[model samples]
Target chain A: MSMDFGGLRAVDRLDLMIHRGEIVALIGPNGAGKTTFFNCITGLYTPTEGDIHIHPPGGGSKRINGLKPNRVTELGLARTFQNIRLFQQMTVLENVMIGRHCRLRSGIAGAVFRPPHTVSEERQAAMDSYRILEKIGLESFVNDLAKNLPYGAQRRLEIARALATEPFLLLLDEPAAGMNPHETHELDQLILRLRETENVSILLIEHDMKLVMSLSDRIYVMDYGRKIAEGAPGRIKNDPVVIKAYLGEEYVA
Target chain B: MTPLIEIRKSVLVSIWFMFLTFPIMVIRVNTVENVVEWRWHNMIAIGAGSFLLSFVWRYMIRRKEQGIRRQREGAGPRLSIFQRIGQERRIFLPALTLLAVAVVVFPFLVSMYQVNIMTTAFMYIMLGLGLNIVVGVAGLLDLGYVAFYAVGAYTYALLNHHFGLNFWVCLPIGAALGAGFGILLGFPVLRLRGDYLAIVTLGFGEIIRLVLENWNEFSFGPSGISNIPRPGLFGVAFSLEAHARYIYFIVVALAVFTIFMVNRLQNSRIGRAWLALREDEIACQAMGVDKTRTKLTAFALGATWAGLAGVIFAAKTTFINPASFTIWESINILCIVVLGGMGSITGVVLGALVLVLLPEYLRAFAEYRILTFGVVLVLMMVFRPGGIVSNVRRTYQFEGPDSGDK
Candidate 1:
């Protein structure tokens, strides 16, 4: 996919892929179009050229270039924000329940009357959201407002909320951006467990080199809106181009 | 930060008071011949009164801060009496039940005039709740809500006047028409948000009223469709005082229904979508909420109750002119919602009661009632910007360790 804002190219023909049950990390310097690529794929911005496709586990692949953000999400792709976009006034559980909005079938009539089906569906959604929270270790803050959570827990809450959507592909934008070492370690364990337990594929944009090196099965490096290298962590670490562009030659040890 | 800065703020506030009070306070209406007269004494009185009020407010706030400091030092109660009352369910529930019982028995203990006023208040309560859905919950700023009210009232009035339809038959038709109008109004204004949306909605309201006033063939050209048939129980019609009582019951039932539906809608998946939309539209969409559909639902749902209230209002008054559904009516309903606390159902009810009944209670003040009302409203906004019954965030009952996080 390629995206151009006026005369400036934000993302230049980026071809990224995430297989089922794999954790793929996209690492790049600031302004290297990592987030722009995420935006294109998630339908926040319609790429000026090329198509982005999603292959749901039970379904066929379809082009999702110009689909609305919600429609793309409905197609089994969910994402978190770099700046933590959890609804601040809402409770943690409420935020996760909002993630379940697409899967639920209640309309105005069903909501008002709340027949047994609607009631059961709502209850099930709540239970599922709670389970996701528990998995992410945010079950204790279920009733607390998202804004009131500690920074580390707020970041984790965003992950739990994204997980509640039941997405086949989860795009996490800077999940460990502000986390300390212990929190980053916790996040690493969480992401690893997510793939093993939830059977979901993960794609993330990150700035932390240690977390990126530890968590990703495969790492893709970019520089100035172009992919410079893609390989296993061992190979990518020693790649001359990536070292010169991002890591620097002496720091490659 | 310091006493000097505080003093500077007080001076600025005083100047602002002078600027605000200069025009209205100086102008006087000569009632004997309906002539405009300038009253310097009145202006002086108002300026002085405003200055005193502002100073008192500043002093009270300073005192409250000192009290807070003292409380922090463990020299006094940690929370205020009002905050304690608010936090304690033991005191709150009984008070709420008493208020509910009082509302239920209000008509029985009062005269027909009071009952009539209570019925009007109930209609406002319903309208307030409806507007709350659009403005408070969905976070859409609507200034043309009276347009929906007008659509519903006119739908019933025209249908009854021309086709001779009963109230029951007209009610659904009116509500559907209102909802349709809601979608029509919602479509073009979806892209515009905040103040821009408010302006367009306001214009829509004016357009509706103007059309009603100009089209003599259809809306009777501001003369309005009169002799509207009152709603009945089965085939039996209510008489005199009983008519007010009966209409009161119907309105009570409708208000109750609005309360129930709105409460449910706020807690449902759709409701969460709305709250999310209100918080952050982009995030809401990214979370799989269809922004267009969600906003439209908010508009239509809010308009639905207003539509029902309009039908009852027409039946209750037995007549409605274009003047009845004015921009001020929309503003009044909005005020009730804001005053009661936006997005709060119980707040809307309390706001309507206080706003409507307070005026009736202050009828002895006669000409000065509006002046008092304006001052009270300003004071309420100053002291309680969140509103009288501001929405308390909902929390679930979890049997886990409670940390003093928030």
Candidate 2:
């Protein structure tokens, strides 16, 4: 996908492929267009060229170019934000419940009058959200406002919220931006467990090299709005281009 | 906590209060004689009283905060009275039942005048709830809500006046027209946010009012359709007292239904979508909530309540005019929503009652009603911006591990 901002190309002809259940990590220095690429895929921004093809688990692949952000989410692809864009005023459970927005089939009549079917569906959705919260170890903060949560928990809540959408391909943008070592370790295990148990694919953008190197099945490196290196952890760790552009000369020696 | 700092805070608060109260408390207008009288005695009394009150209040708040800080350092948590009431499940149903019974009995115990006032208050409550859906829940700042009210009122008036239809027939027609207008007005302003949305809505309201005033064809121009027909109770002609009581019950029932519907919506998936949209439009869209559909639903749902209230209002007054559905009317309804914490059903109810009835009780100062309202609203913004009954955080029955709903 190629994305241009007037004369500047934010993302320039970057091609990435993540197979089902594969943990892919997209790493780049600040302003290398990692987030811009994610934006292109998520429909937050329309790519100037190239197409975003989503192959749903049930089969059939479709080019999702110029679709709305909500349409992208409904196609079994969900993502968290780089800066933790949570519904700060809403409670934790409500935040997670919103993740089930596309899945639920309730309308105005269902919401206002609340027939038995709608009520049952609502209850089931609540239970599903609660279960997701429990899995993320945020059951304790269910009633707490999303803003009131501690930094680490808030990040986890965002992940839980995304997971509630039951996405086949989950994209996380800087999920470990403000986490401590312990929290990062916990997140690593959580991501691994999600892949193992749920068979979900994860594409994460991260600056934390240690977490990235440990969690990613494959690493794709980008710099100056272009992919510089793409390979397994061992191979990319020693790649000359990646070492010069990102990892630095010290790591290569 | 130095006395000097404490005194400085108190003085600042006093100065603020003095400026806020000066116009309303110190100056009295003699509307009958068309003269403004300066009440020096009243000014001095009020100024000194405010200063003293501010001093005491500042000291008390400081002491309370310090105490809370110390407690926070030592304890797990402490629930405030509001939180306690909000969380305690056992007390909730009984309290609600008592309030419900009181509401049913209120009209019978009060005088006819009081009953009429209460009915008006209920209408405002209904309007407030409707606006709350747009402003509080959907985070759409609509300044033209009275347009929908006007549509409903006009729908009823024109139908009853032109076709000789009864209130019952007009009621549904009014509601449908109200919803239709809501969607109609909502479409153009779908992409507008914040002040722009407010401006568009305000303009829409003025347009509706102007259309009613100048048309002279359908709405009877500015004179309005008189004798719009009062609602009947199964073919029985109600006397004056009975009529007041009758209107009171109808409005009360409508208000109760609105509250029930709003409350249910607040907890439902659609309610969550509206709130999410309000909280963050991008996030809501990312979560797969269709922006157009959600916004239109919010507008339609909110307007439905206002339309019902409008029909009731016309039936009770037995008259209508373009003058009644002004921008000020929209502001009055908006005031109730904001004054009663936004997104709170109970808050809107309390806000409507206080805003509508307080003016009636202050009949002696009736000339200063608008001035007093402005001051009160300003004070509310400064002190408790959330409102009189701010929205409490809600937890579903199925939230806890040992929850019976499981």
Candidate 3:
């Protein structure tokens, strides 16, 4: 997929793919268009050239290009922001419940009158959101406002919120950016467990080399908005082009 | 930050304001007399006014800084005395009962003029709550809200004038028409937000008022439809005092109904969508909320209450013209919602009472009333940026369809 802003090519004909139940990592330098690539695929930006397709498990593949971000989410793709976009004023559970908005079907009449179906649906939404929080070990902060959560917990809450949408493909943008070693380790376990237990595919953009190498099933490296190398983490770690562009040459083994 | 420096700054500010007002305040030209009147006293007053006001402004700033410091130190939010009373059920219940009793015996305690004023206050409470849905919960800045009120009032007036419909018959029709107009406005302004949304809505209100003024054939042009009979009981007549009391009860019941419905809607799924939308548009959309649908619903629902209030307004007054539905009318309702606490039902009610009744009771000092009102609003914003009672966020209890499910 390609994305352009005016005369600048933000993501230049980027070709990337993810299979079911795989943890794929996109590694790149600053301005390498990693987030832009994610945006293009998730309908935050419409790709100028390439088609974006999603094939939900047991469902036919369909193009999602030019769909609204919410429509993309409805098609089984969800993402967490690099800067953490959880609604700050809302309680943690409400943050997760908002993620369940697309899946639930209720309107003004249901909200005002509280019909049987609306009640059941609301109950189900709350339960599901609570369950996601519990699985992510954030049930303790359920009633706390999102802004009041500690930095690490706020980041984890974003993941939990994204999970509430029941995505087939989960995209995390720099999930380990500011985390301490222990927190990053926990996030690694959480991402792995999400795939194993939730049956979801993962794609992450990260600068933490140790976390990236340890977590990714495959690594794709990019420089100047173009892919430089792609292989198993071990092979990509030693690739000459990847080392020259991103990973320092001395780190190659 | 020292007091001396602050004093110096204030002197400069006062001088700047004096200079700014020089053209109009110091040199006022009398167009009819063909002479310019140099009112040096006006300049002196402004200079003295701003100089004294500047000290108060500095004091408020320091106090606000202290608040921020306290918050950063994790003292947590200090609940005001009003909030504490609200939390204490013992105090709240009896206070509520006392207020209810006062309302019940109010007409007997006061003259019909006061009763009518109280009735108008309740009508404003309903309008405040209605606007709260769109402005407070949905975070949609609607400035032309009076247009919907105008629709509701005129719906009754025109219906009564053309077809001889009664207030009771026109109430629901007015509400429906108001909602229809809300949707009509919603479609064009759905994508606009913040000040832009406010501007468009403001213009929409002006358009409605101007049309009412100019379209003589359709609306009888500004002289308006009067004698639109007050809402009546089943062919029964009453003394003027009894009728005023009856209208008071009607409005009180309507206000209660608005409170009930608005309270319910604010905690439901759609309400959550609105709150989330208010919090973040992109995140809300990414969460799969259809922004268009959510916005339209907010407009329609908010207008529903406005429509209801409008019908009661015409009935209570027995007259309404385009003059009754001015930009200032819209601003008054907006003030009630904002000063009351945007999403808080309690805040809106108290705000309406304070804003509406305080001015009425202070009629003895009519000249100072507006000045006092302005000072109070600025003080409120400085001390409690969240209105008189900020909305407390809702927490859902986890007990739905299946208990303890996987």
Instruction: Write one digit per residue (lDDT tens) for candidate 2, span B191-245.
Output: 8999999999999999999999999877789888888678986899878898889
lDDT of 1 by residue, B1-406 (tens): 6877866766677667767877777777889999988877776666667656766888877776786689678685454344566689999889869977998898999899999999999899899999999999898999999999998898888888888998899888888988889999999998888999999999999999999999988799888888998887788856888888988988998888888888888877788899999998988889899999999999998898888888988998898999998899999989998998888777788899989989888989999999899988998886667778654634433344332111
Error of 2 at B180 (Å): 1.9
Q: Give lDDT tens digits, candidate 3, residues A49-92.
A: 88888899977999999998889998888898899888998988
Fnat measured on candidate 3: 0.63
Tens digits of per-residue lDDT for model 3, B26-60: 99889999998999899889988998899988788
**Model 1 misplacement above 4 A:** A247-253, B1-55, B63-101, B234-238, B399-406
Candidate 3 docking quality: incorrect, acceptable, medium or high:
acceptable
Docking class of 1: medium
How much of the true A–B contact set does each candidate keep? 0.72, 0.62, 0.63
Lowest summed lDDT across 10 adjacent residues in model 2 chain A is found at A244-253
lDDT of each: 0.86, 0.86, 0.89
Score candidate 1 by DockQ.
0.53
TM-score of each: 0.88, 0.89, 0.89
* For model 3 chain B, the run of ten residues with the poorest summed lDDT: B397-406
Writing each residue's lDDT as its tens digit, candidate 2 over A60-151 gives 99999899988889998889999888999888888998999889998878877778998788778888888898999999988788998999
Off by over 4 Å in 2: A247-253, B1-54, B57-98, B397-406
- Give the interface RMSD of each candidate: 4.2, 2.0, 2.7
Clashing pairs in 1: none
Candidate 3 C-alpha error for residue B369, in Å: 2.7
lDDT-wise, the better of 1 and 2 is: 2
